[model samples]
Each structure stands twice: as C-alpha cells, then as structure tokens.
Target: MESMKNRESKTAGSLIDDPVILRLFERMPHSVQESFTEEQLMHLKVAVGSRGWGEHAVDVRGSFRGWRHRYYYVMLFGRNRRHLTPGQKRIHNLISAAMLTGFVCVGLLIGLLGLYLLKSAAGIDLFPDHSLGIWDWFNSN
Candidate 1:
C-alpha cells in the first residue's frame, strides 16, 4: 500500500514539472489525481511522450498494413456483429462484392491497354490502309 502511494505521488509530482502534462492535468479536477492509479498515469505519460503532450510519438513499423486490412474489413463487413441488423450486414456484403467486381474490371481494362500499347509498338495494323499518316495529311504541296 505504501509503495502504491509512493508511485502515485511520484506520477503526480512529475505532472507538475512537465508543463504540457500539467496542462493536460489542469483540464481535469484535482480529484483526478486520486482517481487514476499509477499504471494508468504511466500509460498516459508514454502516450503523451516525454518530450511533450501535444507531440504524439508512436512506433508503427510493420503493423500499418495489418491495421489497414482490419480497417477495410470493418468498413466493408460492418463492425460489431451484434449491433447490426441482418439486412444491414447483407447490404455491406453486397457492397463489398460490388467493389471487388469493380476492381477486377479495372484490372482487366489495364491489361487490355498494355496489350494494345505492345501491339502498336510492334507495328500491328490497328487502322486500315486508307488511314492517312499525320504528316501526309498536314503537309501542303
């Protein structure tokens, strides 16, 4: 019990020394000091960063892709299964399916465009023989 009190007191003391943290602390009542335990204060300190409270510093080295996938999945498949009606979930699923189909169609169009460019580079006859060259059409005798 003594150690817990010591830690809490230390956290409270540190809050006074750090101006940014003091500001965050000032937003709440003096009773807030007693409300949060040492562990919670430590977490808040880390989140606020030792440099300052407004400056947010986080290490997201390799987890961004996973976070993006989870975010997209929630957006496409409705978050909180219990709260969603059956019809809502079904609509989300249909929207997801439609988006997937659109992506596939776009992929196909890009592939076709690539093939056309390749064929054009290889001197394939895309236009008829009657088609006038730009120089021929533009030149005046």
Candidate 2:
C-alpha cells in the first residue's frame, strides 16, 4: 500500500513538473488548481497537445544573421487539414465545374473567332451577297 501511494505521488509530481502544465496550473486560482487530479491534468495535456507544431508536407525554416541582427523565417505549405461537410464539398465541386466550363467556352469562342477572321482575310464567303459585316467593321477599326 505504501509503495502504491508513493508511485501515485510520483506520477502526479511528474505531471506538475511539465512546463506547459505548470504554466496552466499557475494561471488558475490556487484552489481551482488543487481541485484537479493527475488524470484530469493528463487529459488536458492530451487534448491541448494533439495538434502539434510542424506537421506539414513542406516545412522550411531557417535563421540568418545580417547587419548585426538575427532574422528567422519559416515557410510551410501542405494539403488542407480541414474536414468539409457534404454540402460544402458539393458546393466546392460545383464551383470547380463552373470554372472549367467557363474556361472551355472562352477558349472555343476565341478559336472560332480566329477561324472567322482567317476566312474573311482569305475572301472565302460561304454565302453569296450576304455579309456578317464583321470584316467591314474590323477593317474600319
């Protein structure tokens, strides 16, 4: 029984020794801090520390010295970690499809316009005595 008590006290003491947990404990009122058990503190640490730092696909960090000063820089890029709802996913897909459709429509219009200009320049009129007047307007401009 004495050994068990000693072990429990050691575990609780170790939890208090953690700098992060110690800071959290110090911020709380003394009475409130003392109210929490070691298990509760362990749980709090787990919850707060779950999402750790530097978890990224591309993480570049460096420090440099210039002109008697020190500078630090970090660049991070990675896939998003957010969890989107089904509705949001659908909206994102719809927007992507709309953008792709708009690009294709614009490309086709530009290609057709170029072909029409080429035909007009070659003087190849598919219909006799009928003109779209585009060639005339283009020439005037």
Candidate 3:
C-alpha cells in the first residue's frame, strides 16, 4: 500500500487538477474530511500569488493552470461530486462552466455596479465635460 503521506500528496494533486473542485471551495466550506487540511487552498493561493480569495495576483510562473484544474475538481465534487449517470458528466461540466461564467459575469456586474454606485455617490465622472471628442475638437471651439 502507498504510504499515507504519498497517498495524501497524490490525492491532493488529483484534487488540485479539476475545476469543479475549485468552485466548491469558492461557494462553501469543504467537506468534513477537508475541513482541516488546507493544502489544496494553500496550493491555489501559492499559484495565484495572493491569498487566492480576494483580488487575484499575478500567476506564479504561470504553472497555476495545473493548480487551478486541481482546485476546480475538488471544489466541484469534494466528497459528493463524482460519477453521475451516463450523461451526468456533461451536466456536471455545464454546471462547472456555468459556475465559472457566473463568477465572471457577477464580477463584471459588481464592477459596473460599483462604478455606478461610486459615481452616483460621489457625483464624479471619470471623463471631464470640457474634454471634447477628437473629431469635435477639430470641428468646433
């Protein structure tokens, strides 16, 4: 039998390679088994170069693709995210894709919302009114 440390390392490696796993961590607490071990999360934070939760930092050597895949897989399944019916993998994928896409969309929406809220709250426009479009500048005073 593989040593426990070896097993854990391999298991952790596998988990870090899937996107679904990554999402699970983002959405909720990990399973009971995962409650204590933060290796996967740590790996991700290392890969992302930040804490891996708030703002994303630059990729460390860009090898984080591996880290991201593993993170995603674990989060997608965790303890209960494996082996559906014949087509369930497809559904799972759609769900995973939707999760990521939703994150992007929500991020964009929040960014826009923040901009709007900031502008409205501060009553400050990014662009000045006195500044004319290039063409308008040529055409008028």
Alpha-carbon TM-score of each model against the true structure: 0.40, 0.43, 0.29
TM-score-best of 2 and 3: 2
> What C-alpha lDDT, on a 0 to 100 scale, does residue 105 get in candidate 3?
99
Highest lDDT model number: 2
Full-model lDDT for every candidate: 0.59, 0.79, 0.54
Cα lDDT over the full model 3:
0.54
Q: Count the backbone clashes (under 3 Å) in each candidate.
A: 0, 0, 22
Give the number of colliding residue pairs in candidate 2: 0
**lDDT string, candidate 3, 1-141, tens digits:** 333344358755655445644664566654532553446545764565443243323323222357447332222212353358869878889999999999999999889766665554565656766432433443465
Off by over 4 Å in 1: 1-31, 34-84, 129-141
lDDT value, candidate 1, whole model: 0.59
The TM-score-based order of candidates, best leading, equals: 2, 1, 3
Local accuracy of candidate 2 as per-residue lDDT tens digits, 20-119? 7776867788667766666777798887656655378899989999899999999988977778999999999999999999999999999988898899
